[model samples]
Target: MDATWILRLDAVGDGPRIAVKDCMDVAGTPSTVGCRVIAADALPATLDAPVVETARRQGARIVGKANLVELCRHADGINPWTGTPVNPLDSARVPGGSSSGSAVAVAEDEADIGYGTDTGGSVRVPAACCGLVGLKTTAGRISTQGVFEFSRTLDTVGPLARDVAGAALGMAMLEPGFTIAEPPTGTPPPLARLRLPDVDPALDAAIDDALRTAGLQTTDVRLPQWRSWITAAKDLASAEGYWAHRHLLDRSEHLEDRHAGGIRQGRDFTAAQVLACRRSGRAASAHLNALLDRFSALALPTLAFEPPRIGEVRRGSMTYLTAPFNLAGLPALALPVPRGAGALPASLQLVGAAYTEESLLALGAHVEAALAANRR
Candidate 1:
C-alpha cells in the first residue's frame, strides 16, 4: 500500500492536506480506532475535537483518517484490521505505532504535517523510525476531546513532521496562542544527557557525538527509578482503559483480536490496584519532577535500538523507549540523528518539563540544524 491519502483542504488556499490518525474523530469521517469489527458502526463525529477544530480554523484541510494499531495499545505497529503502516526508511521494519500512518504520511511527503496522538511514544517512535520529527506534548496541554480514549491520564494529541519547524507550526495551529520561542543564537547552554543503562551503545555514541558537534555540553545523569515509573504508568493505563471500555466489552464483540485481549487484561485490574496505581503515578511524577528540575532538558535515545522487523512486532518482542515520558506527563521531541550498524534510522529524544514545549521545540530545531550541517 502507498499509505497516502489526499483530501481537499477547505481552509488552506493551495497547501497539501494530510491524513490524520484514526483515533481522532473528524466530523463525517469514520473512526474505527483500528478495529474492523467496529468499523461498521463507526459514526461520523458531530463536532471536531478541539485540536482539529483549531487546525481547521487556522487553514488546515480535513484529510482522511490515518491507520493505527488496534486500540492504540501497542508500541510496535501491527494492526490486524488495517495492516501495519510500512516504515518508509525500511519496508521490512515496523512503523512504530499506534500513530503509525501519521508518521509515515509525513515521512513520505504525502503531507507536511500529520496530527497524531501519543500515549506512549506513538508519535515519537514512528517518527524516529521514519526519519521525522515527532512531538509528545505535556498532559492536558492540547485538547483531546475528539480523540478516542485509551489511557485518559496519558493521552495527549501532538504532531509529526519531517522537520522541527513543521512540527512546531502544526503545534501552533492546534494549540491556542502557542508562540515559537527562538533559542539563543549565541553559545548555547550545555545539553544534559541521561545515562540510559542497557541501551544500545552505538546509538548512544552517535547521539553523544552529535551533541558535542552541536556545541552543547553533555553531562551524565542517572535516573535509577525510571523503571518504577514505567511500572506505575502501565498499571494506571490498564486500570483506566478497563474503566473506559468495560461497558463496550460487555455489550459488543466489536473489538479487534489484540484489543479484545487487552480489554480482558484490563478487566483483571482490581479497584484497589487501580487506586494504588494512581497513587504510584503521583509519587512517580513527583520524583521525576525533582530529577528534571536539575537539568534544562534530559536526552536519551528515542529507542534502545533500531526499528524491528514488522513481523517481530506481531510476536511482541520489542516495546518502545518513548513510553516512560507519557507516564511522566512531560514534553518530548524526537529528532532523527543517524542510522545504526544495521543502517536503520535512529533518533535522539529530548524531554523537558511540563508545558515546556516551546523550549523543547526550540532546542530540537537547533539540534536538527546542527545535524544537517554536520551531514553536509
Candidate 2:
C-alpha cells in the first residue's frame, strides 16, 4: 500500500492524528504537490502553512505527506510518477482525487483525520469514494498561505475524517482564532434537496432514504440555469489554473500528458472569456444563496455515480457535483451513506451558506447518528 507519503514523521503528539496533503507546507520539508518532476527541484518550506502550524500547536500529530494527482490537476486519482493510492474500499476502482491519499489515510485508519485542499471537488469526491466525511470550507475562511496554488479563485483547505465530529474537530484546530458557534442541538433541521437532471437513481434513492430516516424534511428545488452555471465555473477554474502553472506548461520538460492537457485547456481561454465566466459565477452564487435562504441546508449527491474502475473514469462525463459549491465559495460537507448490499459507498452532500459550517456540520452529525440508529 504505497499511500504516497513524501515524508513520514515520527508520531509525536497525543491529539488528533493527521495526514496532510503534500501540497501543504511542512516547515523543514519540501512541499511537493505529489509530483516527482517538480519535487526534484522543490525548495524546503521555511515555515509551515497556517493550517499545518495550527494543527501542531493544538497537539495534533502530523503523520505524513499524503499523495495527490499531479499538481492537483486531475479529478481521477491517476498519476504517472508516484503510483496512485489504492482505494481501500475497492482495489479495482480509482480512489478519487486530487486529495486521494489524504482520504485514503483517514479511511484506512492510518490517520484519525486528514487535510486536503479543494480546488475543484478534490477533497469531497475522494471522501465520497472512500466513505469518509469531508468538509470544504468557505474560500479564504482559512488561510492558504503555505499551500500550492492551483486555482486561486477556487482553492480552499479542508478536512476528511471517519465522521462529522472528527472533521469538525480538525477544522476547529486548523482555524485557531475563528470561533465556530455551537451546533443546534437535537433533531436534524429541515433540508433542501436539490433536484438535478443526470443524477444516478440509486444515489438519489440512497439520499432520500437517509434523510427520511434522519427525520429531516426535504424540499425539492431546481435552480434555474444550473447547467450554465456549472459550465461558467469550470471555465473560471481552468483559466485560473492555467495562470498558476502556465510556466510549467510552456517550458517544463517533465510535464505529464494529463496534467499538461489541463493546463493547456486553461491556456485556451482569453482574458475576456475568464472575466465573463467569473461574472456568470458570481450571478450563480447569488442565485444559489437566495434559494438557500429558505432552508437550513441544500442536499444532493456528492458525485453523480459510484467510483468507477481506475482506468474507467470518463473525466468530462463523470459529474463532480461538488465543484459548483467551490465556485460559489459555500461551505459543503460530504456525508457517506450505505448504497446497498455489496456495493461501493455513495455520499450525500449538504451545502450551507458561506461561513455557516457549524450549523451544517451540526445537522450532518444529527443525520449520521440517526442513520446509525436506523441500521441497528
Candidate 3:
C-alpha cells in the first residue's frame, strides 16, 4: 500500500482535511522539524503526537506533513531543507512562517485546515499572509507531548483555515475536552481596541472598517509596556529553544547559520536571566488580565505592516506585536480582513483572557459570519 494511503487511512472521521506541520510526529514519519540534519538520521516516530492522534481520531484526514522554517526558528518561513512554500495570494511574497507550508496548503486548497505549533507568531503570520484564519490557543490548552519544543511555556498547537468555522472545527479535534461554543445570540461584549503608537494607518483603517461593517463597538485601551515584555519573551524563547535542541546542535555535522545563530543566543543566558524573564511575563499577564476583565477582547492588527519579501530580514516593532500574548499565555485569534492596495490580506487580531478560547471562537465565528454576509 502507498505510504500516503496508509497515513490517510488512520484518519477516522469524514471531516476536514489537515496537514500537520513537519515539527509534529506522525507515527510512521520522521519528525524533521524542517531540518536536513534532523531528518537525515531521525527514526520514524513510534507514536503520533497527541495533537495529530487526536486530529485523526476526530476524523481529520492527515493529508501530508507541511514544511516549516529551519528548526522553526525564523518567522519568515524560509526552509533550506524543504524549499519555501509560496503564498497563494501573492507568489512573489513569502508565505509566513515557521508554519509556512501549512498556511500555503490551506491557501491553495490542498487542505481544509493546517495544524502547526505556534511559538511566537508562526501560525498567525502565515495565516494572515495567506488570507486565512488562525488561532493560537492559550498555552497548555492543547497537548504538546510529541511536538518539538520551541519554548515549553510559549509553545502551542494551533490551526489555520480558510474561515473561522474551519479553525473552530480543527480546534475541537486537536484540543482534548474542548469544543466550539454555540453561536452567541445576544449582543457581544464591548471590545477594547489596542492602538499601538506606531500602528500603520492603512491597517488601522482596515480594522475600523471591519468593526464598523460588523456593527461591533470598540473602546480604546492600552496594556502594559509591550517592548519590555517582548524582549523578555525573546530572551526566554531563545534560552528554552536552545536547551530543547542543544543535543542536535552539538551533534549535527553541519548546522545552518540561521539555526546556529538562534541556538547560540540562548547559550549564554544564565538561570537568573530566565527567572527575570518569567517575572516580566507574570507582570504583563496580570495587566492583560485586568484589561480583559473590563473588555470582551483586545483587538489589534495581526501584522502592523505588509509581509516582508522573501529573504528580507523583517526588522521593526511590527514584527513583535503578537509576542506579548505568547509571553502572557493568552488565547489569540488572527482573522483575515480586507486586502491592502498590494492585494495581500490584512488581518485583525483578537486576544482573549486565559483559557477563553471557546468564547474567542464564538466571537470570531460571529464576526466571520457577519462579514461574509457583506453587511456593509
Candidate 4:
C-alpha cells in the first residue's frame, strides 16, 4: 500500500487523534499539499490553519499530515509524487481524492478523525471509496483560512471517519459549538430520494433497501438542472482554481503536466462566462433551497458508480453525483451502507439545507442503525 501520510510524527496533544489533510497548515510542518514542486518550495507553517487549530483547542492529538491529490484537483487519488493512498477496501482499487490519505488514515484506524477539504467531492468521494463517513459542511460554515484551496468559493474543511459518531467528532473539531443531533425516535425524517442518470443498479438497490428497512419516507426527485449545475461548478472551479495557484507557474518546471493544464483552465473562460457561471451557482442554490424547504434532506448515492480500480477513473467522472451539492453550498453526509457480505459497500449521500448538518447527521445515524439491524 502506498504511504497515507506526507509526514508522520509523534502525537501532538492529549485527546482523540486527527489526520489533517496536508493542504491545511498544521504548524511546524511544510504543507506539502501532495505536490513535489510545492513541497520543494514550501516552508514550515508558523501557525495552524483555523480549522486545524479547532482540533488542537478541542484536545485532538494531531498524529500526521495526510496526503491529497496535487493542487487538490483530481477526483481519483493518483498523486505521482506523494503516492496514492491504497483503498483499504481493496488495494488495487482507487482511493478517491483529494482527501485520499485522510480517508485511508481513518479507515486504517491511524486516526480517530481525518480532516479534509471538499470543493467538489474531495471529502465525500474518498470517504465513499474507503467505506467511511464523510461530511461536507455547508460552504463557509467551516473556515478556509490558511488552507491551500482549489476553489476559494467552494472549498470547505470537512471531516471523514469510520462512522457517523466519528464524523460528528471530526465536525466538532472543525466547527466550534457544533452539536450532533440525537437519532430520531418518533417519525422518521422525510427524504427526497434524488435520482440521477447512470446510477448503478446495485447502488440503487442498496440505498432503496436501506431507506425502506429504516422506515424512512422518500419522495422521488429528479432535478432537470443537474447537468447545468455540473457545468457551472466546473467553470467556477476552473476560474477560481487558476487564480488560487497561478503564482506557482514560475515553478511549473516541477509541476505535473496535468496539474499545469488544470491551472490553465481558468484562462479558457471569458470574464462574461465566469460571471454567468457565478450567477448560475446562485440559481442552483436557490432552487435546491426550495426543495429543501419541503424535504428534511435529499438522499442519493454518494457515487454513481462503484469505486473504480486504480487508473480506471476519468476526470469529472467522480464528481457527477457530488458536485451539485457543493455548487449549492449545502451540507452533505456520505454514509456507507453495507451491501451483500462479499460485495463492496455503497455510499448513501444525504444533502441538507444550509447549516443543517445536525439534522442530516441525525438522520444518517438513524439509517445506519436500521441498516445494521437489517444485516443482522
Candidate 5:
C-alpha cells in the first residue's frame, strides 16, 4: 500500500534511465494514469507526449512507468488499483503524490531522473517527502501535449532528481535550452522569505536555519491574500480536472467513491463559482508577480510540515502549501535540507517569476551547496 511500480520496460539499455509518471504518454506504452478502469481498456500510445519525446530525443531511456494516486486526485499517493511508490527516505511516511512513483524511482536510484506533473504540488510534495530535487516549471514552459489531462489549467510537467545538479540536467532534457545560470559571483541570489500563518513552527525554524547557514540574504515578505489564493486555485483545478476526466463518470463504479465524489462536486460547481476563481487566480498571480519583480525568487517551505505516515496523512495540507505558486504560473524548485543526523529533511521552495526557472534553479543549487557545507 505504500509503494509499488506500475510497469517497467523490457530493456532500458544504456544511458540515463528515466521513470515517467504513468499519466504521460510514452510510445508503445499504456498510460493508465494509475487508474484500473483506464488500464483495463488501455492501448499503447502511438506517439510519445511532447515532453516524453524530448527525453527520447536527448537519448534517455524509459525504464518504467511510475504509479500515481488514482485519477491524480490525491496527495497521499495511495492508489487502490496500483500500489503507491514507497517513500525511500522513510517507508512509514506517505510518498507525496500524484507523482509518487517518480520520486521513489529517483530516490531509490533506479533511474537517473523522474519526469512528473505538478498541478498542486504533485512533483514538489513527493520530492520533498523523498528528499529529492523537484522543479515545477512556469505554466506552459514545458509542453503537456500527449499527456493525460487533469486540471489542464494548472498541470505543468517537471523533473524530480536526487540533487540540484541532477535536477537541472533533467530540466534540460525536458526543455531544450533550459539551463541553470550561475550566480554572478557564486553566491545565492536574494530571496524574499514569505511569512505564512499556521504552518508547523519547527519547519519554519528549519527554513530559517537553512537560509542562515547558506548566508543567503532574505527579507521577510507577507501576503494578505495567501489563503484566498490557495482556495481559488484549488477550486479552479477541481473545475478543470472535472472537465478533463468527466468521461470517467460513465464508469464510476471502477473508481474509489471518494475520487468519484470529488469529481461530481466539480461538476456541480456553478459557472459563477468557476468564473470567480478565474478572476481571483489572475489577481493572485499579479500580486505574486509584482513581488518577484523586487526579488529574484520567493522562498518558503515546500510543505507546511514533513510527510506523515501512511493512513495518517492530513489531506489538503501539503497541497495547500504548494498550489498557490501553480496558480501564479510561476516556477518553483524544492530542495531538501538536512534536519538532523537521522531526521527527515525539510524542503525549501524557491518560487520565481514567470519563465524564470533558470534563476530559481541557480538559487536552489546555491542553497544546496550552502547546506552541504554547513553539514560538513
Candidate 6:
C-alpha cells in the first residue's frame, strides 16, 4: 500500500504531525479530497483552516494530507483516486472511512493524532474500525472555516487516537481552553445505555462486559424515534448538500464519483420534503436533548458489525449505527473494546450533550483504561 497519501507524515515545528482528510485546507497544499476532477483545480490554500492553524500554533506539524472516501460520500473508506487505507489491526478489513487515512495514520503510529472531519460518523466510524479512540465534538464546538463543506449543518472537526487521554489532548488543541472536568470526588454519575433494536448480539455483549469491568452502573433506556431522527438527518443533509454542490453537478463530468450520485439525488428532492425534514429535525433535537438531560451520556455500539473486508464494503451492505449523533449535533466518543475473534476491533460510542466534550472524554478515559486492563 502507498501509505504516503494516508500517513501525511511530515516533520514540522519540533516533532512529526499528520494532516487530516484532504477536505481540510493546509496552506499551499492541494485539497484533492479524493477526487481526480478537482485535483487539477485544487489550489494550495493561502490560509490554514481554523483547526489546522490551531494545531500549528500549538506546535503540531503538518505532515501530509490523509486519504478519504471520494467526496466523503460513504462510511466504507473507498477512494478510486487514492487507494483506501488498510486497517492496521486487520489489513483485510476496511479502516472505516471518509476519515480513512486519518484513522490509519494514527493506528499505524505514523502520527500522534490525525485530524479528521466527522459529518455523519466519519471520524468515529473509522476510529472504531481501526481500534482507536475518536471524538466527534458538538457541531460548531470547533471552527470549520477552510474545511470543505459536506453538509454545513452536520460537519464537525475532531481527532482520532489510540486512547482517551490522547484524544483529550487533541481536543484541547483543537478547541482552545478545553479541560476535561474532573469527576466528582465521590461516585460518578451512573452510565446510561440506549437499547438499539436489532443491534448485533456480540456487540451488545461486548459493551456489557466493558461497562461491568469499568465498574460503572448501567441502565437501559429507549429512544423510539431514533429512526425518524436518522431520516431527518439524511433529508436535511441532502437538501443542504444539493445546494452547496449544485454548480459542480451541473458539469456532471467534473464531479467526483462519491459526490456526483448523491448530489444528483439531492437536487431532485422536493421542496415539501426538505421543509418537512427540517421541521422534523428541530423537533428531534428538542426530544433528544430532553432525553440526554436525564443521563450523563448515552452509550451504544460504535458500529453494528465488525469491520468489513476491504473489498467487501464496496457492496454497501454495512449498517450505520453511529450516524444519528451527527444529525442531532451531539458529541460522541468512539472507544475501542476488546478484540474479538479474527483480531477485528469493535467499539462503543459514548454520546454526550452538546458542548459537553470534557465530560465525554472523562467517561471515555475510564472505559478505555478498563478495556486496556482487561486485555492484560
Best by the lDDT measure:
4
lDDT by candidate, in order shown: 0.77, 0.85, 0.81, 0.89, 0.86, 0.80
Per-residue lDDT of 197-311 in model 3, one digit per residue for the tens? 6677888888888887778899988655877888998998999988988887775556777688788789999999999998888888899999899888998899878777775
Q: Write the per-residue lDDT of candidate 1 for residues 129-198, one digit (tens) a residue.
A: 7888999999998988988998998998999998888988888778757867777776655556888677
Candidate 6 error regions (>4 Å): 1-9, 254-258, 314-319
Better of 1 and 3 by TM-score: 3
Per-residue error for 335 in candidate 2, Å, reads 0.3
Please provide, for model 5 over 24-51, each residue's C-alpha lDDT reduced to its tens digit, 9 standing for 90 to 100. Answer: 9988988888887898899999999988
- lDDT (Cα, 0-100) at 77 in candidate 1: 71
Candidate 4 local lDDT, residue 180: 78
Which lDDT value does model 4 have at 332? Answer: 96
Q: What stretches of model 1 exceed 4 Å from their correct place? A: 1-12, 185-189, 248-254, 314-320, 340-342
- Judged by whole-model lDDT over C-alpha atoms, candidate 1 comes out at 0.77
Better of 5 and 6 by lDDT: 5
Candidate 2, 280-312: lDDT as tens digits? 868867877887788889999998988889778
CA lDDT, candidate 5, residue 183: 82
lDDT of 3 at 369: 76
For model 6, give the 10-residue run with minimal summed lDDT: 3-12
Q: For model 1, which pairs clash?
A: 20-66
Give the per-residue lDDT of model 6 (tens digit) for 1-376: 6742733534646643655778898887778878766676777789888898888788787777889987777888877667878887877878788899888888888777888998888899899888899999898889989988888888899999888887887887787678887875777666678887767788888888888888888889878887877777777777878887677765667665557888877877888988887677667667767877777788889887788886677433342566678877889999988855665666988988888899889888888778778777
Cα TM-score per model: 0.92, 0.95, 0.93, 0.97, 0.96, 0.94
lDDT of 4 by residue, 110-174 (tens): 99999999999999999999999999999888889999978877898899988998888888887
Q: List where candidate 5 sits over 4 angstroms from the true fold.
A: 1-3, 11-13, 185-189
Candidate 2 residue spans exceeding 4 A from truth: 177-189, 250-253
The TM-score leader among the candidates is 4
Error of 5 at 360 (Å): 0.8
For model 5, what is the C-alpha lDDT against the true structure? Answer: 0.86
